[model samples]
Target: MKRRWLLSLMAGLALMAAASAQAADPVRIGFAISKTGLFAAGTGSQFDTYNFWKDQVNARGGLDVKGVKRPIEFVWYDDQSDPGKAVQIYEKLITSDKVDLLLAPWGTPAHIAVSGVVERYKFPMVGDSAASVKLRELKPGNLWFTTAVMPDRFGPVIADALKANGLKTVAVLTPQLPFALEVKSFLMPALKKNDIEVKVNEEYPPSIKDMTSLLINVKNANPDAVLVFSYPADSTLYMKQARENGIAAPFQFVMVGATESWFTKQFGAATDGIVTMGHWSPKVAAWKKAQPFFDAYEKQFHEAPDYLDSALAYMSCEILEQAVAKAGLDKDGIRKEISTETFETINGPVKFNGVENATTPASLLQIQGKSMELIWPPSIATAKFEKKPAWPAN
Candidate 1:
């Protein structure tokens, strides 16, 4: 009886040991994003892209930490596009949930708010969306790395396009966001240098629904070009109002909404000849693998991916994955590695310049026949520019 009892006790101990050995913790990544709110349209695409990356990584047995493969898990919250809410959620992610790593929230305002919390926690975070020159000014100690193109770079590109197209005058309408404002700031000098006269510059609140007066004023100014720098919804509203008010310049350069499939579908052929910024297209040869990424995204999402959001999401994860592999899961190690190394991603080689900014080249694309065609940077242009017809009578 004694011998049998001892054997059973030994078996129990062995089983417990085996169970302990088998229970490995997953690598948890956390962030707050706009599931619903003003930023929802863009964040929705970003969320989908992050999920797609997560699935792809987990399918391959997750991230390689040192030499062992651990499954990846995400702990996220909906910030509802509020910076205050995002800050609160990020604090919880750091202290209570205790995520293994962190990803930046959706836009510049949210990111700016959450950045303080990240700094305190010293988590290595990759920012996918936010790109204000202010981020560099903050000098956040390399804890944060940005994936999106900086506004400073965007101005010169747009100026070049304006000069190339023989546009001598422009009117600017921008949302009063840090990134948009920075873009405008950078653009003004370039515009002046390029001999383009600014006829009218207007700032609108993001929540402003009616742009009738703004469009009317712009139409009256009758500049050779009109530049609209706003988010998707505002850009859409502006375009709708511009069309309704018969406000068509020889060159209309809108920052957002123009590249989106939904935007094109909503306006139909009316979207033709309207130029906007594009980060990646299948036609871009910088990353030969861009076509494959585009195909995979469409197959996974059942729609064309938003170029900026999709590229930022995929490349941000890719950089994080690479940094982890090299740095062995230590936050400080990852931060140092990311700050110092240039990551090769689907967006091509991303090397951080001074002020923690990385150069992701921008191209101007025009809609032609319900399709986005790269028209600027003739070296990489997929299609030539098509002159816009006069706005249809309201």
Candidate 2:
């Protein structure tokens, strides 16, 4: 009788231990990012931020899941900024690694390619740099979400800025990509609505090495302002050439230049007064918690954080954490929670419209003196624009 009682007690203890261990298993998150290729800077910054979040969470005893803190395990794969490759890597993440959550890769081309796969897996993902409006055109599902400021949100704001600034004729240079197309679609309409004339419009291939000819042509056309759509490298080159060749346009800005700090660093004095459309800036009190984040990031990486990538990564994780806490760890439950969800983030308040598949009340910013300043929508403008950049300078 005594032996039997001891055996029964041991069995009960063992069962409870197993249950605890199972509950404490790490939650796996999957990331497909550009380890190499054209968009590496953006994706690389994103990975750095993600790792920072992972470290911070784990250091705090991991995530609190039903009274248990489980460490998060991220399974990352290099997408190489190739869409087909991104699709393949995503498949491995879903089938082999079996990640509990998904993250969008960098660059528009890769995102456009792998979005279908993410949708198929029914996973919620927010990318650091994939901000095209086309992502919302697909069928709305419970597991699909993004936090980046879509171009449509900024296009109208820019058009209004142009009209207000008395700039009527503008030259536009766009990259041949989905994001550029989406931006142009909104900007053209908004410019028309504001009665601003597009004097010179051109789209160049992604591989174009030299833009001297285009600059010369634009100089000849002599538009009031020049707006170029480009990534960091292209942006740096364009500015350097524009200055050296004496394009001397009082106004020049690149839509995506705001994402990387290198834009200002590379351009230095030339970048002193460039205007840009950005979602977040460190100067804003709205992201008060972000100062510690920025400090820690610089200490670890010996580099200042890319506000665009870091903020997006942090907000993305915040949304995932909220959804999981609300709906438990089950995939289906999290999916449902994300669909009807609305939340505030570091970049002000955000919500998926559930209709047009886009975000609203996105902030527009300009680089004034040495800092990014908010300039639009009145509700969130911390600082007004003093002097906007211009092209075709006298």
Candidate 3:
């Protein structure tokens, strides 16, 4: 009888241990993104998308962990698009608030600024920026990740698109930012390999208000195509000025114009012919997941999304969901889960190539009548390239 009583106690203790092990904690994820300054336009869209995904996941009974579910809660701070402030907020989330996960800021400068803090604390953070190859050069820790495509690989995609269209001579303009410059550096080498002559190359200040002089120089070069790389406001200014100056070229592509919707709404027909590299255009195959987000975003915010950055931020939230589900709401567990990606996202099958860059395929995109279309990489493309029927018509 004593032996039987001891067995019962042991079983009770074992059951208690099992119950203790499966107990869940409220998952608190933190985000530090640009809400002001130059990157605000991009980050604002990003923040909306992130919240959209967060709500969607929570509405579906939160994240599925093994066999149970837990709701997600996030603590966010506005980096204001300032690198220094980004660092401060990041520390606040990790050290003070002790959030379970960290989401980094937008833009390369801001990402680089706070990367060291993440590395030191060893907390998992996926940001909207850090697409540069340099981000991967940092010391290895499972704590950092991003969904931003490498800006360096993007140069080759641009060259390929231009080459396939039989354009040999082109003009390039880049903004004076780290990622933009990295794009130019990589693209110039690829253009050289393809024997594509760069008739004109120019760099403009980050926020060039009026680009009359620059447009005049580009017109003088008279290249067959032109590639413009700049931040949103500057990119918009350059395109508007290019049209006003009557510098028509057969092919005009905007490198960072993934947020083509914003520009098209403002520029109308002038935004018609711009070609861009997009991560999640409404036309890509992955839009199956994105369409719902897009519809909800437009209805709620009354604005179409800036695909690439917005998608990056949205996926950051989803990443948290997956990590929390696998790691059981602990930082160490979540960090391990993040280090290994096993599913596709709204942007398609996603796995971080390194701490800085993601390996998702690029979608070549164009604007068509208030909608964005995917035109290249045929398998995932939603439409064929239709040359802009206006000014620079072939």
Candidate 4:
């Protein structure tokens, strides 16, 4: 009986020790993305990067959760490109699903809508695929945008770039949307400051399928530069119509779609010298991680990532990963770390000031030859700006 009792105690001890050494459960992070509807074209890169980041983390012994390593699992829902629906989905992720962390949705309106949900629950979210000057007004603790392209400064940035390049007059065609309109509001004022004459100024709906009339107006005005403040859907429309209408502006800027890799692939040689929005580029030697990320993403996805949204998404992920490593799973602790520390990202060191990324400047990207290169804010520019060559007659 004494011998039997001794053996049983040893067995129990071994089993408990084995159990303790096993890995902890995955850290469940949740988000809502527009898988269907209007914003879907733009959402592809942001959504892909979120999953890519998750895969990379899991491949390398999981994420460090305050020194305790745990794999990441995502609980995401499609918001159908509706802000109201995005709000409802986030509420479910927090209250019902009880996810440990939250990621942002695509576009300004959705980000704005979901901001309230995160705030009400005091759930911290690092924003991706979103930005606005109005973001400055929101309470700083719960939400912070990863992008520096807040509309308040975007206009001035462009106007400054054009002035530096010796472009004299411009035609501005803005979309009827929160972010685009805000850009127009500031850009018009900045143009006056620069003494650049406006030959044309127009606004169209986000759902607009025809830009023939507007393109004609732009062609008729024959300004030195043409600015089409367009989202993806309307961007495609404008590009097709502009080419057909024989728009001759040497400097042409289509706000959103041109930055994505698909935009270049589809337009091919026609894409050269077109300016759009973006800051980070793999060609920049200053940011150590930029090239590696570009190579790794192209390898994994079989294509180049979106210069604007993909960089923002991955950068936000890097910030959150670092914050988690420092502060663990506690909401308040993670929030504190993100707010106070500077994170090393592909965009270089990012430090937050209130709800905005205070480090990187508002910069514009021009698709030159085959790659997107920074053309604005000469401090970070990868290449000199090139004039838009005449479109080939199709």
Candidate 5:
């Protein structure tokens, strides 16, 4: 009887040990992201931020999922910034590589392409960059969530700023991409409704390099404000060309440049008074939670964080980590948790609205001195709006 009892005790211990070992196994997350091609510069910092999060989590002994600490592993592929390739790679990540969790790629087009696949597989995904209204219209199920503030929210802010500053007329330039088009769709009507005339509403090809003619045309129109909706490269080019062509407007806004550190670094005093939509800045009191993240990111990466991309990437990971912890290893549970819960991230408390979009206010940032300052939305404004932007000497 004693021998039999001892064997039973030993068997129980063995079972417990096996369960512990299984719980300790690494949790694999996968995604395809742009490492090259058109989306490269835009996605580069975002990708690095993800790596930074991974290193931080692992350094702390990995993610804690339902009381057990599981080492986190990422399986990623370069999508080369192509939507078609992103879709293909995401399919493989879900079916072939069998990643435990999935993350959305860099932009609206890529996210829109992969949304169906994520829904089909019922894999929960968090998008860091995509903000097109089309995503909401698609209603791509509850499994997908986006951190980017929708265009509708940002459009009104810009319109209000224009109205406040007494800018009577504006010229708008946008890339032909869905994201830019969506923003333009909202912004044009908003400007018109605010009694602001849109002198030149032009859409350009994404690959267009010669914007001199376009700038000259806009210069001739002589609008009070000039808004360029493009990515970093094109935005920078437009600003340089605008300066070179001596196209000075009372207000100049670019959708992409002011939020990036490199934009200021490259343009220096030239970036002064340039307005852009931004996600986060260290200056806002609401962003106090992000200071540690900024410090850690700078320490790890040897550069200041790009608020637009890096902040979004880090916040997405934070949400995923929380969801995984609360929901355990089950994909469906994580999806439900994320949909229902309000996640506390560096950007403050983020809760998904009915459409699986994170409800966060967008900030209008302007370059003042060498740093970007939040100027709109009084609740978080770090500085008053400069009525007339002080243009640099050509």
Candidate 6:
């Protein structure tokens, strides 16, 4: 009788331990991001921000899943910057790997590509690193953009900003990629509305090695501002050639990439005053979480986060974390939660209308000294718009 009682006690203890272990299972979140190819350089902000969010959550005991807590285990793959590859990877993560949740890929192309996969699988995902008018097609649910960088709003905000700063004419150098083209499409009309002349309008292929010719044309036109609708590689190229070629425009705005730490590291003070498309900056006191995230990211990576990409990446995670905590990993529940909730992000409040972010205003950022500052729309402007300084003679 004594031996049987001891055996029963041991069996009960073992069962309790088993239940505890099962309850603590890691929540597997899966994603595919550009690890190589054209989009690789831009992925660090997004990929690292996701990991940072994971580490921060795990450090605080783990993600709250309704009443239970679980450590996050990322099940990830590289998409090589191919949209088709991104779509394939998501399908695999859902159907084969069976991840509990999904995160987004790195750009407009990838987001638009994976939108179908999420919709088909009935999986809800919050996306960063993408902005386009095309995202409006993925209506009503499943995927949501945390970025307010839609080109339709972006174009007019820039035109208005330029007009406000006393710029009458501009040279527009656009790349043939989907995002840039969309930006140019709306910007032209906004420029007309603002009565800003497009003194030099040039379109280059994404693979173009040289922008010396374009810059020369821009120089000859001698517009008040030079706007290159460029991605990272060409953004770098523009800085290098613009310095060497001396494409001096008082107002210089590269549609993307100026806020990247590498841009400043490479160009030093030259990166200062170069405007870029972004809404978030650590300097904004109103965004209570903004500076803390900046400090944490810099502490972890020993490099500043990309103001646009990293901030959006983190905001996407925050939105997802809140959704999971409330909805408990059920796909339909998570979808409904995300669809209805207004998430507080480092970029400010994010609420989705269809696939677009409705609450955050379309805003612009400029690299000012060692900081990126909001300088648009007056209401959220951290600092007034300033003219880009002359390129340093090397």
Question: lDDT score, residue 167, model 3?
Answer: 84
Which pairs, if any, clash in model 6?
none
What is the overall TM-score of model 4 with all chains considered together? 0.94
Error of 3 at 16 (Å): 30
| TM-scores, each model vs. reference | 0.89, 0.85, 0.86, 0.94, 0.90, 0.94
Most lDDT-accurate candidate: 4
Worst 10 residues of 4 by lDDT: 17-26
The runs of at least 3 residues in candidate 4 whose Cα sits more than 4 Å from the true structure, single-residue gaps closed, are 1-23
- On residues 210-240, what C-alpha lDDT tens digit does candidate 6 reach at each position? 9999999998999999999899989999988
Q: What digit string (tens of lDDT, one per residue) describes model 3 on residues 1-394?
A: 9999999999999999898678655467787877777878766666677677767767888667654776667899888778899888888988899876666577788878888888778776666645777877876555354444476777787787777777899989888988888888988988998889999998988877888887888899988788888777777777778777776786777766546456777777777767776757654544477777678777877888777777777767667667666776566777667767654566765676556445667556777656777666666667766655555322
Q: Would you list the C-alpha lDDT of every candidate in the order shown?
A: 0.81, 0.70, 0.72, 0.91, 0.81, 0.90
Error of 6 at 81 (Å): 0.8
lDDT string for model 5 (1-394, tens) is 9999999999999999899786667888898889899878778787888888888989999888977887888999999989999999989998999888876688878988888888788787888787877767655444454454588877877888888878899999998888778778888888889999989988899887889989988999999999998887798788788888887887888886557667777877888788887767776677667888888888887778887878888888998999988898798788788888888888888888755555667668777766667787777778877743555785
The TM-score that candidate 1 achieves is 0.89
Clashes of each: 0, 10, 0, 0, 0, 0
lDDT of 4 by residue, 62-168 (tens): 99998988999999999999999999999999999999999899989999999999999999999978888889989999899889888887889999998999998
Backbone clash pairs for candidate 3 read: none
Per-residue lDDT value at 3 in model 1: 100
Question: Per-residue CA lDDT of candidate 2, range 245-268, in tens?
Answer: 776555566766565666667665
- Worst lDDT 10-window in candidate 5: 140-149
Q: Which residue pairs in candidate 1 collide?
A: none
Q: What is the lDDT of residue 56 in candidate 5?
A: 90
User: What is the alpha-carbon lDDT for the whole of candidate 1?
Assistant: 0.81
Worst 10 residues of 3 by lDDT: 140-149
What ranges in model 3 sit over 4 Å off?
A: 1-26, 65-68, 143-148, 257-260, 286-288, 356-358, 391-394
